[model samples]
Target: MRNAMTGLALLLALLLASGGAAGAADFPLAGTWTLTAADRITPAGVREPDYGAAPKGRLIVDATGRYSLQIFKSERTGFASGDKKRGTPQEYADAALGSSTHYGTIAIDAAAHQLVFRIEGASFKNWEGTTQRRAYDLKGDRLSYRVPTAPDGNVPVSEWRRER
Candidate 1:
């Protein structure tokens, strides 16, 4: 009986050591996020759809407030391609004719919980070089992000739920 009890106690100790508390959502946003929608707010305050390759890429943010972001912009607009994901030389030529690109940069304000994203490289052609900055909020199992208006009386709002 004494030996059995001792063995049981040792097993319980090992289990407790290995099973720890759940971690905070501190570093989960270190992956690629695709752009679901990009809106072009006309001067009349009416929002329109400006087509481009779906903005897709990865974001690597370190704990020290340094990060790298790579996002693929619209690709199909200026090409006559034989395959998807890669365009033929002619397709490349065509795509360049219209001159469209896609990219995103991100900086986080942990104290204020705001996310500053500077987008350029062809995505801002419609916005006339204005880098849109938005408020970012994150809670347990919930993420909320908002973009303020362009002062032209039109604003775009975006929300992202945890992927998993």
Candidate 2:
């Protein structure tokens, strides 16, 4: 009887340990990722090319439910005036069109494979304090998501790879 009880206790301990480790492995959304590609798809299902040939971006999501993302076209021309405040109107417009940034809290619904971003602020004032939901997939180190159609009716899909 004593030997049987000892064996059962050992088995129970091993099972509990394995279950805890599995739970940790299931939550893979916490980490820093860099954007590798971004494409726009029209409502009619036409897929456009990426934002630029060498687009650059970074995305960071903390374990504590916070995230920030910044993406910009590579090789933006510097202001000819050599002063940020003195840039020409054309330069300002070009800058705005080439880059976007936003920061906010994030929530992951693992069961649903969805991510929710509650924007606290953004470079574009119109997006301040808005909540967005995206269907996300994470495979190995690659993460991708399909953003809902924007207010302008343009759908954007972005892909990121984990930064080692």
Among these predicted structures, which one has the highest TM-score? 2
Residue range 46-141, candidate 1, lDDT tens digits: 766433435443444443324453333455454345454688766665455333343455567677677765564443366434465567666654
| Per-model CA lDDT versus the true structure | 0.51, 0.82
Q: Candidate 1, after superposition: displacement of residue 129 in Å? A: 7.7
The pairs that clash in candidate 1 are 32-58, 53-74, 78-94, 78-95
Task: Give stretches of model 1 more than 4 Å off.
Answer: 1-28, 32-102, 126-132
Worst 10 residues of 2 by lDDT: 18-27
Residues 1-164, candidate 2: write the lDDT tens digits. 99999999998898676653545444566688999888788878888744677888999986556789998877566799988899988888768877878999888777888888899989889889999889988899999898888766778888899887
Give the C-alpha lDDT of model 2.
Answer: 0.82
Q: Model 2: residues >4 Å from true position, as ranges?
A: 1-27
